[model samples]
Target: MSDGWEDSADAWVASQGEEGDFGRRWVMDAPMLERVRRRPYVRALDVGCGEGRFCRMLAGEGIAAVGIDPTVALIDHARRLDPGGDYRVEAAEAIGFDGGAFDLVISYLSLIDIPDVATAIREMTRVLAPGGTLLIANLAGYNSAADAHGLGWVTLADGRRVHAMDDYLEERTAWIEWRGIRIRNWHRPLGAYMTPLLEQGLTLTHFAEPPAHGGDPARQALYNRAPWFLLMEWQKPRAGSSSGPTGRA
Candidate 1:
């Protein structure tokens, strides 16, 4: 959990002011919020909640949410920005909560940052109540794979630029440097994520590669070809629950 994130905390906070970076502002915000509103949750937990942005969003709507992150500096920012909010410095892999304590658990753009995604998923699932939902926003596997080797967008002989992928089946790590921020991210194939979730007995209730909105038209068109993000709602079935699994949206 401690992979030198404290160094990048300041730059990250500055980068994600109020609206967030390009991805959150345009591609993810609307869709993620819309899906969160579909169900009511008495208690919610946001794992890997850097600066607690989404937790604050839920709080604005009168929903109480607890935000957790391992990085001390980021947690400080969260507490400083929203003094009355609940923000804890805790790792996703070792969340400090009882089993079935939260009705809603969210991992927003955090799977990539987490070094141990499997352990984190297990912990999140453990803390989730039956009939609860685990809402996630993440970098699509295709996008992650494409950037694995740092040789993105190769030019073809016919002058067409296409994203190139390598070592897709293997987990990869790379440092993302942007706007004075430098942080490490892990990339795993689509199956690497799905297999663990399925084994944990969670049902895929909804999935989608939603489109971007209110952004530059050219960038939006580019993302349409290969989505930069993905949304998934995984539900744990209640006892004797006859409700069946739902597919991709």
Candidate 2:
């Protein structure tokens, strides 16, 4: 499973030979980076920072950013894109940064493939500076991926076919594919997603359910009908303050 992804990461960078700026500038990375412009964070960590798109964006914004990804190819490509900030090939779960090192820690659409996601979240919390924000965007809710794939169906216990969102959530599985690489994207209720953060000594400040992009205005109009992805903002309370969770949005 991991081998295909390791190769896919390299192939992805190779395929982006040019027009890489198109994605880093206009697509996913740019939009999210723009969203955090008003944040007062000075230092940030972009975990699983594949290709360092977000890392470069942060560096451009004057934030001292460090990008870490397990794929060497991605890091190499990132270095070529922007050598200003630090870039390292590392695991999302075993980050070596000292505790309370960054004012912000972000993972853009990278949590789905992480096997021990809870452990990864804990690592992120460990590195987060006091009163820092940890932003995460990932596939959310059951049937979200099926909707993205333009499919609608459910599998009963007896292997019967049913076609409905509710039925699917109750029985079927949903997966996500990025740049032709299919991976298991575990979907959970909004509370289930927030539960781990609470356990990691973080509090959810805000949540977003954005519209999908496909070009069809009518289809896009209905995209927000069901949230396929969630942007969760969590904060770490100040050190020596209180072990209890408390933070302003």
Candidate 3:
């Protein structure tokens, strides 16, 4: 959600009740949390922490977590739901926190929403402490259709369902509007993401286009045909390290 986020905040929050939408609840949560569990982090930050969901999750795991978002309404909701949580209204492109402040930083499904991704990524990397982890869960490039007509299964001429995609390599914005939720999300090729992080000297620790688990059969098939999300773990280089993360996978 972008400039219109205030109008759509309630619906977005409602769509993700206690768990999240299908992608977050069934697909991304387990693996994302698993990656978090792999390393011990004393302090963590959630870059686009909508409603403080992931931040609360990190707190549950005994980590001191802080959440930041550009939407004031969403931050208000987050503070209401999580009274003691640290929820701030801040943009990812320019985090107010001091550099090297967080041991673990996450940008969960918020990368596509930020209009200035390069600056946001830089800020996320800046807040990360040496040897810290930046775990990301993002929509697959194909999912953010340029036309924004929405991407899913469609019956072909032979009556076989296929996911149609026209521009996989194009960087564009998709105005996603549905069921009272309207937000602008960006679509970029893998290079649009990878190159910047690599330039920052961040090491790729783990990457996966993991499948959904223990869900409706039909839904699983749909997700398999064209993955809705992918997870990536990048580690900031320590002062003297020349290699990647200690636990590479």
Best model number under lDDT: 3
Residue-level lDDT of model 3, residues 46-95, one tens digit each, is: 99999989898999999999999999999999999999999999999999
- Evaluate model 1: give its lDDT: 0.85
Better TM-score candidate (1, 2): 1
Q: What's the lDDT for all of these models? A: 0.85, 0.68, 0.86
- Model 1 misplaced stretches (Cα beyond 4 Å): 148-151, 240-249
Return the clash pairs for model 1, or none.
Answer: none
Runs in model 3 deviating more than 4 A are: 146-148, 242-249
> The CA-based lDDT of model 2 is what?
0.68
The sequence of per-residue lDDT tens digits that candidate 1 reaches over residues 61-177 is 667899999999999999999999999999999999998999999999999988878899999989999889999999987787776444256789999988877777888888767
Error of 2 at 53 (Å): 0.9
Instruction: Report the error of model 3 at residue 86, Å.
Output: 0.1
| Predicted structure 2, TM vs. truth | 0.75
Query: What CA RMSD would you report for each candidate?
Result: 3.4, 5.4, 3.2
Per-residue lDDT of candidate 2, residues 200-223 (tens digit): 768677676555544456545444
Q: Rank all candidate structures by their TM-score, best first, as comma-separated numbers.
A: 3, 1, 2
